[model samples]
Target chain A: MIDKPFNNKAWLFVLPVFFLVAISAIIPLMTVVNYSIQDTFGNNQYFYVGTEWYTEVLGSSRFHDALGRNLLFSGIILLIEIPLGIFIALSMPRKGFWVPVCLILMALPLLIPWNVVGTIWQVFGRADIGLLGRVLTGLGVDYNYATNWLDAWITIIVMDVWHWTSLVVLLCYSGLVAIPEAYYQAARIDGASKWKVFRYIQLPKMQRVLLIAVLLRFMDSFMIYTEPFVLTGGGPGNSTTFLSIDLVNMAIGQFDLGPAAAMSIIYFLIILLLSWVFYTVMSNFGADAPNKEVG
Target chain B: MAQISLDKLAHSYVAKPQTDADFALKQIDYVWQDGGAYALLGPSGCGKTTLLNIISGLLTPSKGHIRFDDDDVTLRSPEQRNIAQVFQFPVIYDTMTVEQNLAFPLVNRGVARSEIDRRVADMLDTLDLKDKARQRARGLSADEKQKISLGRGLVRYDVNAILFDEPLTVIDPHMKWQLRTKLKQLHEQFGHTMIYVTHDQTEALTFADKVVVMYEGEVVQIGTPEELFDEPAHTFVGYFIGSPGMNVLPCEVDKNIVHMAGAKFTLNKGYADLVGKLEIGIRPEFIDVKSAAEANGAGVAIQVTAVENIGRHKIVRGTVNGYAIDVLTDEDQSIPSDAYAVFNTSRFNVYQNSHLVRAHS
Candidate 1:
């Protein structure tokens, strides 16, 4: 098909957005790209270091450990949150006075700032003065998030789940309510069991929204930083050191700008590639499957 | 398969209905025979859907009972009632193929795999969906999706009655006739007790053995389409049923004579002691336009206003003593400026307060 000729005047409407994106994204990205390819010293002197920082970051055991931990954490959170959110949303009342009440309660966790959430969990997991730690310790369990690597990981994961699961619940709830009442009535008249109704009717209707929820949760969990940083501080022997935490420690703490910049680009590319894969696979699912004749 | 009956059935959305207007469906008592096709005909918000929902056991009536055969199923759930309902909008399992959607009801009821396959295959052919049988229901057009919905209702052989609440409302005008004909064919072949609800008179007249005409939450009359058109029980029915509906004009009843628009006509039955607002109703087809001299003693004089030729016939509209009157005539029949409108006395119906007046003992 022949393409329509472009209008030069259409560029005027897009110039503001292009300028905003350049200032907000491309300029910072180019700075990262520039740093990734060069080495800088204290006297405003620099040396071109091509592919060295990239190779160093790629071969580092620290990066590998952090990447593995990040993947594991995101996977675990998704496994817990998606189903739990759906369950909570399904159990919620479909209408009347309780709807607003339930919605407000579900939105409470999301309204809390990320660092405040981390700080709250940090204190809450302390065995010395925190209520949860005191109760667990009182229950005769050895629990201390400050010094124990496994305990620190557990606390951070729990904190992440508590902070973000509501987002999934809200999205799923909107999807559930959007379904017309006729579907349920039809299912009932058709003699469909509760499980069949949920599996076939409700789930399919909620697919689009669930796709959005899954994508948002995946991206957010993959790049999770503030909460874990505050709660675990990449401490308890690096057990809770996720990818973002390691990047921040390298770039900010140790001032290893070259390796950190290379790692940042790699991180961005990984997120972009994974998101594309997720979008394509999910959108193609149950869409235009080859027609097979029955009988 | 089953005779459905509603006994003094009434429903209201409000918890405590204090007035008759509060009831979505006023008291209704009727029985639909087994293996009969009936239509609940009414304008929107006339309780046609409310009555359908009540019969399908989707909504529990605030008062009275519903029975299938000899069993009182008023409190039973929809599944327990064994009823099928096709909504105005098509409802199908979007993720499933056409075959799967048709088989859903049978699968839910735990029918044998062979039986489900056979029924699904049959429904696919019957709905003319054999070519699209394997396609996902989400990809089908509105009419095709609706056909799938209808197939789901028909796939279950054990259903007591199939209730349709304007099932063809969303179908295209051209496809509507085809689906309606298919529905009639299915009803005749299967001998199922089908109650189709619609506001369209043509649909009601064509698909139903009996049309129950409802007005403002109450059933005005229940009869064959011919009976409803010929003898409307209430003035609302006269106004609602026919195109260019019956003209109901204010009149004065005196002994055996009815005086209307400064003209006098004799009644077949006398109502000497009738004490209410009197009116006479006649269909436009029963009125003839004649010259003033020829209709001197037989008709009332009218000032002609407009004549509309509607392909098959012409509708002559005029004023009889400042009241609008319509007369349906052959297309070749020419109207005059000052014409006398003559009523067929045999087809004349008198109403006392919006209800037909029948002679008493």
Candidate 2:
């Protein structure tokens, strides 16, 4: 290797970035860490707690229930969204005037603010006067989101899917469009069926974008708060209180600063670990295509 | 294994073509014999690829029918026509291994597994890609990828014809020759009808038994390399097929004599009163450069401008009465200030309106 010139002045170039990160992220995290290790009472009086909050938060079944709910919600949304998004993207016109129109319609949901989407779904799913609820109640089905936990869950799930599936569609559309026209021509000449073309050509080409979509949707759904908070205010019976909402309730609603800080740290770690796992697994997909006969 | 025929084939990109100029391929009526290796040669935007696409059923001509052994395949798809085409750049399934890429066409047709394996193995060996058989096709070099593209076409044994559209454009210069030789060998061994499209003269001249020369959406001439070289039917052919091309000079035709550039030359055969713009065509290879004393009152004197020493021969570029003329001479020959360009009478061709005028003996 060629010898690189020894230069310590390069470190000066990183000073601005260091200060930016310290101000934006590191400083706040340190305050949370400080709170997790101490007990705070009224008038700023404090005492050393020494991991008591960590033990209580980790052992509580409320935390376990909220974590389970978050996992299930993320899982259900992903299972519905990824395939549906890919289908919508594939069905969209590849050319002509309608392409931009379809793209704009897909993007419309994403442009709406998160809480606005929640409030829109909240009124839309109201059994008293909303169109969907009125139609369901008139059709003889008992649909009430205010009291029934299952109805609340279904409403939120539907609302989330409607709001976010467009993101997945746009990502997958860009991937699909990036594929060259020659590949399609070659596939036609090879006599491949439509399914085979998708499996061997389109699917492989979309792998990178799909990985990104999965990671974003997973993290976004896992840390979901604004929509569910505005829609059901955590739920009829704490059934839809996902991790972020539960953390907010503990930190601000009940003012359990120590335990909530401890819980938030744990929540952050779990997301980091799961995202790493997802990235590792998704990036390795199709690395080595199946070989019937090895050379 | 089928003789492909194009019957009055013409295509226009526009829906309503008002004139011949609108046609991308203007009325091509030719038949490629079974087991024949033909090259469709032309410059870019000359509709060579359009004609190749029509033959492979990737395109349906605006008019006329395409037949493969009496079966009209005008409305058929590429799959229905059983045609194979290798594109300009390599088009391989990136997720497939080299062997799988080669076997794709056969697999899609539902050929027996054993047959696919055998054909793929044979193709791998033929293309010298056996060493990389298990490797993913995407990671290979461009030439290797191109070989896989060619292998995919060759793996199908019963294709009506294999069409190539500038398939070697991405290949390295050295690799182009090897792949071209391999293709020729494969064609000879299997007796498959092949139509290779290219803008390179050397590729067309070397790979084809009969070279179909096209110009501006029209088939100008169809002949062997020798025929194209010896007597180019059109002035464009004479200019396009040669290295320095043919020297075309405006002239007046009178009975059995031709007068050009203030000089007179006699023809072997008499020509009746020719109409339209008249000219004489001669290849640079046939013209001899002589000193003034050596010319002996024959030929015309040209003001020599430049000389290029191209290894085996020297190209003498000169101008006579404002018309540029090139003469090929042995590399060792010395140039004199008073250079005379003697036309080889037997090789001279007369043209009327850019089309060759045959002399009546």
Candidate 3:
């Protein structure tokens, strides 16, 4: 073990970042807590409401719809990305000059700002000018994402999958490469079929990275606001109004600060609770995950 | 339980060899008798492991025909070949218990439960892994993991042969000696056709009945350990099979006497055909050492470079007849700065153009 007297010195190193987080995060959190308990009238008049808005938000139908929609979106995103990413990763050649080229292409969308992706897709889906809409209309299919709830949901899910599945593919590919060739040779000598080799050897070896892919995809999809906000604008009658977008609408558009603050607290708690559940399930069921693949 | 025959087996990693310079494994022919313990011994990248993988059906020979017990298996997969292989590193399943790992192949083949249990139990007892049978293999030490791998290889009685690719490499030195002994005993008990591949001469010599010495891409010699040490067929074999290796010196043969460094050494026999391009080889153990000049004491004078006391013997590293040589003597033997080194002519061998010309004078 390292001697602790390396000492209060390491604490000094972390002090700057800690202060920055405290100012930007902790101060606003304290303000939210204050709002949770108190209400104000027109001219800075204050009256203690003490959890009334919290109970109200908890019972609100709009809050329930946002929460459910958020969950459905996260579930759909994870379902689409994990297997599709693994398939792409498996189909790729193990070694070649094309490997780095393929990797850079996969990473292009990830490096772009999320808002820019939204802009690109928004213009790309315009029926009058964009290619996708032009192609679909040219094919004699009636498609309007802005006017139909089904089209809006399908478009949002597709955008999320295209934007995020590469992350999963890259992680799973790294995990697969970490497996030693000796293991594959042993499997071959054992007379294992191709399916068995994949099920028993490759899948178990990739469990740890698969866990990271699952959690990351879940959290990002649940809190997704920018792309759907720009593309569908939570339109076609609230079909794509995930919790993150609903929270913004309540806090800024409607200017209902107290209720939105309560909703924000609830949203943070829900993300925390769901993430904890994912962690517990993965640790218990997939406890034999290959953590030493890095080495 | 089966004889394995490889007929005209050849492999080239490239499309074509330009001037016969690039074949990884040249065309070769050999047969392994059933229930024989054989070893393919060679240094690294000599195609020994590649040949082992091919025979195990992990790699199909680019051009060849393979037969197991008179049945053509050249186009078969590893499953159809009925061969088990143990690798250099431990390859047992980490998630399974030792018993479970040994029983995996048997269960996959739909063997009855009772037979699987009986076989697994027997293997556990044979490997001395009964205590670890219930424990997860992931937590076991490297040696223990290797024991599990060996047990898995031996679990099925229907396998035609068992191939080992330097399986004791990860084992500790002290355990390596013990494991090699255990493997030899297992072969004797089961009467299984076994082929082990290793670069270590001691491991090959002490454990195998027949040793195949390979160099570059071809088997240079195949004989019993005694034959390999007593008469190495190739120069590479002569150097690769012994710890200190054989000492080779360029010499000119005059009748029965070989002349070099302005000195003449008499041989036990005469070889008139080997007059030019002659090289003489002497085992380090067979080189006679002396100190004084009298009678037959006029030995080859050598510049003694260093004398090393290695437990039971003193290895005298020096230059004799302008050629580097090492002569082993008793620990108490005093090697002078300039000493007399003489190889017993009866123990000498003469080579012409890298092939043995005469074994006796």
Candidate 4:
């Protein structure tokens, strides 16, 4: 049988979104591309530099340090948040009045603006006035996020976890709720232990959502800017200076357009490459993971 | 292997159930014999699943005692009770192979590794899943997953009973019959007390030696398939059992004579002082279609409306005195316009207020 004729008119429905994305993302990306390849002193004057800035940004230890810090931060946050989020979701009430209460409380951190969260934590981590700092200091610990490198890193990591763990919790909670009651009943009849039920049933059912959680947390933490900028300001000797903060310092702070533009392009490509790698490895792992059947 | 007994069992989802309507299952005291295959047959919301859950210890009845061979297991968990249940939909562990899924319960019970392997292998062969033994359960079709579910229940030899809650609901029609026969064979081989629940009459009648019919949270009748068809205990049973169900007509009863739709029908037994809403029930198979002359001024003259040829038998639909009645006739039986519908008095059942009323001796 002849296949139905292709519907060319479907393009009309897609034109609006295509034009919107072109204007909002593609055009700006092209401008960044243009700036990255050229050297501009001022007043629209341009000179073709041809990969000189790429080499400079790549060779700079400052860019390297910031990239390393971003990777460490993303790694630490993912390790903490994914498991903790799943733990909290598992402990949460499956039904009754407390369900909405727990959900709304978990969502509160996510609803706060990033800058507001950073500002709140910035004041909250002050040793003299903040409850956390005062408690730690009163307990005879020399804790000061404003001056100590380790303190700064700890405070920033804690703040990031506080701000983003809710997203993971919500995703996992939805996955847990979508599981049918029959699986648990069957498990009970099978005399399965709690861990076995979780290992074989709950964990497999939550895989898709857990993948989304990992990807979102990774991308968000890697590109995290406003929170750290407001809280630590990438200070305490650049201990918490992530990649985005470093890129901003290059582009707007120093006004080093050529190097900053090149750094920005490299940053975008790094994120893209890493995310693609993550997607490929994870999707393949998911496919190869036995017992990933959904009921 | 164990005789299951439910003593004064009742359940309600409500915190404080003051009325019978609030209860999901009314007071039920019944005993299921050891090594018997029984079916709990009912329409939706009739609490068959609720009763099964109570027996399996998945649910605790509001007031009841569940006994297995003289042992009180009322407060025991399903694991402790040693019962196996297959749900309406297949509940196979997706991450495991078919063999692993079958061996799960046995392994959980700390059964020896060799024994578990032997049991799993035997179950795989029995379920015709030997080829798919090492295949992940996630990719199997619904019927195959259900077969795995059944195999999981059957793999454990120590289970007291196996409860199936509409296990064939997701199975395709052809596969349903095959799996059903396999289940019957398994029951014969193992001698496990099995309680199968379903709303489908054919599945109930074919699979069960004795069918327990439930309606509106109460057990209406519990009898063999032949008994259920021949003599229903309530109007709901009459309506819910057969294909077209039993034909129940309103009647005015006076001793042995019953007047209905301007015609009189005599009963084999007399009902003296019978009160309340009176009605007569008769199965379609027992109704006879006769020519006007052959009827010999007996039976009710009905206006024939429709004749449905149902392969094996023809159903004659007609109206007598504005009351509709159905007569099951042979395939070659010709339907005449002027036909009288006759009811075999020996097979007639009298109902008073929706319940079967026995005639005075």
Candidate 5:
């Protein structure tokens, strides 16, 4: 009933979005592509390199290391955040005077600007003045994120968990609330054990939101740079120099704009490819669920 | 077989019930004989649903004792009660197949695998969902999902009772009748103790052996459909158990005569000794339409308002003594502009203070 004739006039309504993306994204993307294929010599000189930068960047061991670290961080975050978030959402109260209070408290961290999280933790993990480091030092433990690669990694991992666990919790709580009470009643009558209820009903019902949680956490953790950058300065012999950090170091520190742009394009492509896989899999799972029911 | 009994049951969702109004469900005592089919019929916000929840052990009553087959189970959980409940909406695992959803209860109880398969297969065939047994529940329509809920309830044979809370509300118009008929057949075959709760009278009247009509916080009357129709024990019952309800006309009762609105009418008997609010109730099915001057049958008179001619019958609506009445006539019956409704005197009952005056009936 809601379907109407497909008119070309609809293009007029979408023109603004098309132009906005083209200017902000398409143009910059074209510039990166141009830089990947071309070489710029000193004093405004130029030469055609034709995929030379791509071969060099792909051959670099530093690129491989950064990609491995990125994948590891995303995997760890997903594993820790998803189940922990579901537990917290399940234990939360549904309706009462304290419901809004509890929700507001959970949301306070999500709204506190991502970069500010880095800065706050930067001062927070300091040995001399930071609360965490001061406590650790007092406990007769030697901890210095600035000098030790292990300390840097743990600090980044813990910081990422603190900042982004709330997002997963929020998404999961919404999914839990969306479940009708009838399902619970059904579970009760079926004499389903508590674990069975969680497995067959609660877990399956949260699939869509869980997918969203995974994608958001993966993208955020993979692209993470600011916190580690401010906390350790990619220090201890570049042990924590993730892709984004290295990209910044190459472009601004070493003045290698061509290679940096090429690396940026490659970085953007990796995220795009993985995200597309996730979207396809999630949507396919959704469509396939119903068809199997009736087929 | 289980005979469910409630002894002096009362519930209040407050710290203390200081007055009668404080109770959400007033003190009620009742019983359902083994294998009896009963319906707790009431409008929304009435205590019928709450009472059902209490008996199901979803809620413990503030003051009561409950028994199943003479076993005191007032402190029992829903698990301990061993009762099955169907919800208003379909509740099924969208990820699981239809056969799996039906088999879930058995598997949870660790029933024998072979028996589980047999029961699940039988249910799939009964519900006509055999073709969909392998498909996930997500693809099924609303009615199909509801049928799964019902099938899951019936798939088990050892449960104490099956409770339905308006299970047909979301079903399609055509499927509602079929599902109701199916449920009736299941009851006849198995004789499971079933307590159905519904606001719709058609469902209650046709499905229940005894309809427990509830109003506000109390059970007003419980009787067979014929008893409720021919002689309503309460004004609420008379106004509830049929389409168009019964017409309640305020009347002044003498020994054998009644005065209403401005006209005098005669009945077979009268209730001069009846106390409290006096009124007469007659079902739409028993009332007949006649010319204004014709006066053979005994009952209050009326003014014809509108005529709705259904294919098989006509519902001729009118008002008598400032109270509304509807008379059913054949589709071909002519309704005069000025008509007098003849309320079948023997079928009518006089209510005093909302309760039936038995002496008059």
Candidate 6:
């Protein structure tokens, strides 16, 4: 074993980051912890009620419904966005004058603010004045997002796909371009089919970038609030309410600070746990495989 | 297997090449015999790689007809041409095991499963990778990864030719020799036409049956290693082939007599009215160094500068009348403080405008 030099002064350099994180993250988290374990009445009078809010929040069927909705939304968006992004990236021009044009077009949707995207889709999907709504109506289809929970879910899902698949495309594109030209030349010499080339070369090369894209899309979709709140306002009957939306409704809408605080902690832990699982599984992918035929 | 021929091959990166300067590879016609080993040897930016790429069907020549035996394959793709190429760096499918990588080409061509397994196993034994056959290719060292690349190419039995583009550049020195020998043995066993490209003279001389030397986007000479050493078609070949290379000195030729740097000598063969930048080329091994008095006014006086003792021989570095010259002698041979250098007439060559001039016997 190599001997490492010991230095107490190293901690001094870490002090700045430690203080910044405490102020920005730790302090707020501690306040939430404090609120979750106490009961607050009018004029800031409080009484200790340890673990009561946690039990109440965990046991509620409404919280379970919101959690289910959040997982379902995140799952649906991930399934649609990941493969769609890779397909679009593959179809994009790899060379010539059209490359920059295609890149700028892909980046356009990502530049729009989430609230703006939600508002635009809200107006665009209206039955009377919106083009999409009128087109569906002209086609003799019953379409109304304001009254139907399915319509609200479809509108929000489509809007999110439009605004976010481009990010995945950009990430995958960068990964694809970074591969050396030699690999392609060798593949051609080997008489590999287009699909085999993608399977053996392109997909493996893009694994790291795809991991980042999946995690980002999962976390963002799970914590979705601004866009859906603007578009469906947690739906006609909580059909589109996610964890963050539910947490906001519980804390600010109903002023149930204790229960909301408990729910927030659980939400943070879920995101953290899921991201860690994703990172571990994705990074270990193909690193260790059974000694079997590649096919 | 089929013999390959290039008819007036040339290439230019420019869309419309206006002049010869625009061409990266000048027009040339040559034939590589079936199952022959040929090396494209040259310095960097000399179009050797470009020529190899053209032959491998990775790049199409601007003006050329490439024929395998009789069929013109000029515009054919690499796959259509049935070619295999090992690149400078290892290009292995990271997800596949060593055996899978070796079997990939055979599988793609729809070879029988038993045949693929047999060939892959044979290749694994040949490459000394049998122990790692089931391990992922991504975890191998650079040289081992390169071996997999070679195995992939060699596993296929029906490829027209195997092209190697400095495939040993990434290998360590000790391993380079071993791999080179392994490649030569494989060539002999398989008898597949191979074209190896390298800038190193040792690699070219050792690997190829015929070495095609290129300079400034043009092939200057194509000959066996001994022929390249004995009779260089151009001055660049003589300068490029040897350890210290050949020493070229400006000389005036008249009939059979040659006037050198402040000295004169008679030649056995006569040259007929040679003109335009005449010089005499002689390898360092052919030059003799002796004491000035023993020369008896037959040789030119040279100022001995430095002597390097290389285990088997000593190289005498000096200048004769402001022209640099090198002489090779036995290590035990004592260099006289005042040295006189004589060129062996039988081994000397005459060059006019950098091209060798034929002698009138």
* Collision count for each candidate, in order: 0, 0, 2, 2, 2, 0
TM values, all candidates: 0.95, 0.94, 0.91, 0.95, 0.94, 0.94
The runs of at least 3 residues in candidate 6 whose Cα sits more than 4 Å from the true structure, single-residue gaps closed, are: A1-4, A289-295, B294-296, B304-317, B327-337
lDDT of 3 by residue, B50-100 (tens): 899889887787788889989989888877888888899998675667788
User: Any residue pairs clashing in model 4, and if so which?
Assistant: A291-B94, A291-B95
| Global local distance difference test of model 5 | 0.85
lDDT of 2 by residue, B156-253 (tens): 88888889999999899999998899889989988889999999999999999999999999999999999999889999999999898999989999
RMSD (Cα, Å) for all candidates, in order, is 2.1, 2.4, 3.6, 2.4, 2.6, 2.4
Model 1 C-alpha lDDT versus the unseen true structure: 0.89
Q: For every model in order, what is the iRMS?
A: 2.7, 3.8, 6.8, 5.3, 2.8, 3.4
lDDT of 4 by residue, A77-185 (tens): 9999999999999999999999999999999999899898888988888999998889889999999988998988888889989999999999999999999999999
Residue A75, candidate 3: alpha-carbon lDDT: 89
DockQ of each: 0.54, 0.47, 0.35, 0.47, 0.62, 0.48
lDDT tens per residue, model 2, A152-181? 999988988999999999999999999988
> C-alpha displacement of A92 in model 3, angstroms?
2.3
TM-score of chain A of each: 0.95, 0.95, 0.89, 0.93, 0.91, 0.96
Instruction: Please give, for residues B1-361, the per-residue lDDT of candidate 1 as tens digits.
Output: 6999899999999999999999999998999999999999999999999999999989999999999999999999999998888999999998888888998888888899998999898888888999898888887888998888888888888789999999988899999999899999999888899999999998999999999999999998999999888889899889888989999999988767888878888867777467788888899999999887767768888888888999999999998988899899999987766688998877877888888887542
Give per-residue lDDT, candidate 4, residue A96: 98
Q: Per-residue alpha-carbon lDDT of model 1 for A76-172, expressed as tens digits?
A: 9989999999999999999899999999999999999999999898888789999999999999999988788888888888998898899999999
Model 6: which residue pairs collide?
none
Regions of candidate 2 where Cα sits further than 4 Å from its true position? A42-52, A289-295
Output the lDDT of residue B351, model 6.
92
lDDT of each: 0.89, 0.91, 0.83, 0.90, 0.85, 0.92
